[model samples]
Target: MFEWMAWTTPVVVFFTCIVLMLIAMTVWEIRSPTVMRKGLLPIATTRGDRLFIGLLTAAYINLLFVALGEKMMAWFGLEQEPSVWISFALSMLLLSIIMKKG
Candidate 1:
């Protein structure tokens, strides 16, 4: 069904994961509803709100890494490109903290 878009494997997998997460969230909500809560962020947020914030935060983190990775590598005298795993890990950590506290 996704063939027409001609997306690469990673792109396809990323979107598939996102779709699956949304489905899972929907099911969980139907089973047990979530309440809005205020966290480090200024406003109250629900599970869906937290998910959106996490995704946006992850995207920005990845973009910032991509934009500055080269400069950072050069400054540190690194020979290879920076690994994206760092950004992924940081994103997950931020998501966890937000979900737990916010």
Candidate 2:
């Protein structure tokens, strides 16, 4: 409905921007990378580096939500349920594990 969309427009725009920026960063990394030298070896040319970048991006997003989450929920007329908090916490833990592996 028009009314529904009118309210969701801003949220959609914000998310879309975030997605686009992430895609751009990823493409840039793939195209060009800055190298770091350690001792007598170069250690920046690794797939793990890309994985780490993605994980860091994901963590930044999650932290952004967790930091301003309460306000966003209230703005959207969403209730702060305990189960939701628990799920968010679990998700963060899972993300941490993925980062650790990376």
Best by lDDT: 1
Q: Which ten residues in a row have the lowest lDDT in candidate 1?
A: 93-102
Clashing pairs in 2: none
Go through the candidates in order and give each one's C-alpha lDDT: 0.88, 0.57
- Candidate 1 global TM-score: 0.88
RMSD of 1: 1.6
What lDDT does candidate 1 reach at residue 21? 95
TM-score each candidate.
0.88, 0.35
Candidate 2, residue 67: Cα displacement in angstroms equals 0.5
Residue runs of model 1 more than 4 Å from their true location after superposition: 1-3
Tell me the tens digit of each residue's lDDT in model 2 across 20-56: 8668757866898544423211343343454455456
